[model samples]
Target: MKIAVIDAQGAGLGQTIIKKIRKEIEKDIYIIALGTNTFATSNMVKAGANVGISGERAISSFCRTNKIDGIIGPIGVMCSGSINGEITPLISKSIFNMECTKYILPLQKHGIYIPGTRNLQIKDIIEEIVFDIKNNLVLIS
Candidate 1:
């Protein structure tokens, strides 16, 4: 299966997800990195993603076509329209409106507040993602 790891300007989270996927799933799978920019995409690619797509245009196009089996990242990746720097409305709408499956972390959920996240390790995020995805696979079958 193909999985898209979507992320904000920081690719660390996407990399964490890739690491988790590698350790958990033995089957052949494709990791598509959809970054908010080139830096984020490159980081994820270095981590493990087979392919990386960056830039606002690329993100919107990818989402529009629904080319990925699933996505993982922060909801802020979908926030747009002058709300924050580089958060365009088109990309935001595409991400939020898209119907693709996601392996969103608990702290990344919409309207969910996570306190004192300064020291949260990447491994912790990976573990949660792995657990969630494994559960999802079982439930779907």
Candidate 2:
């Protein structure tokens, strides 16, 4: 299975997700770290992603052309002008257009809200994502 963990800024969230996925997923999964900047990408790579790519064009093009089985990231990744505009419009559109299962973290920092998810903590959300991937995508793909 192949998964892409997308993040911006310092990539703390992406790093966390990669670490959890590595620890939880027993299958031989390939992880791609997509970050809006160098620092973010490097941090996720350090967190054990198989490969890391940064910047708008590279990330957007890769998402548009790659065969990623799953895409994981905060809600900001889908919104243009998110993360103080670090997530470019191309990046958002490319991710949305990708033909893959996407597990988006309901992070309100992007000013977007998902009802019923507001009460869930980050740890809970991460756990749910990891569980879903392991139980569903991993087994099927």
Candidate 3:
């Protein structure tokens, strides 16, 4: 299975997600790291993503042409004017319009909050996400 982990800025969240996913899921899977900048992409790559890409145009173009089975990222990825405006309208539109499941971390920024969510640590949230992916998604390997 192929999963795209999108992030911006520092990409610490994306790196953590990749590491946990690798540790938890024994099955062979391809993780693609999509970042809004070089720092983010390189960080994710160092964390063991199979491949990494950066920039708004690259992200938009890849999402348009590639077959991404799933997408995981902060809620900012889907919100235009998010991540300090790093996520463009095209990127948001492409991600939202893609025919793939999205596992979004309910991170509140820029006055956006995911209602009813507890103030869980990043590790706890990632564990839940990894568990959900393992239980809910079918992997072909």
Question: Please, what is the whole-model Cα lDDT of each candidate in the order they appear?
Answer: 0.73, 0.92, 0.88
Quote each prediction's TM-score.
0.75, 0.95, 0.92
Candidate order (TM-score): 2, 3, 1
Candidate 3 has an lDDT of 0.88
Q: Local error of candidate 1 at 58, Å?
A: 0.7
Clashing pairs in 3: none
After aligning candidate 3 to the native by TM-score, how far in Å is the CA of 58 from where it should be?
0.9
- Please give the distance, in angstroms, between residue 13's alpha carbon in candidate 2 and its true position after superposition: 0.2
- Evaluated at residue 81, the lDDT of candidate 1 is 40
Kindly provide the TM-score of model 3 when superposed on the true structure, using C-alpha atoms: 0.92
Candidate 1: regions farther than 4 A off: 81-84, 106-125, 135-141
Off by over 4 Å in 2: none
**What digit string (tens of lDDT, one per residue) describes model 3 on residues 32-101?**
9999999999999999899999998999999999997789999889899899899999999989988888
Worst 10-residue lDDT window for candidate 3 reads 132-141
Superposed by TM-score, candidate 2 places the C-alpha of residue 95 at a distance from the truth, in angstroms, of 0.3
Which is the leading candidate under TM-score? 2
The residue-by-residue lDDT of candidate 2 on 120-140, one tens digit each, is 999999999998888876477
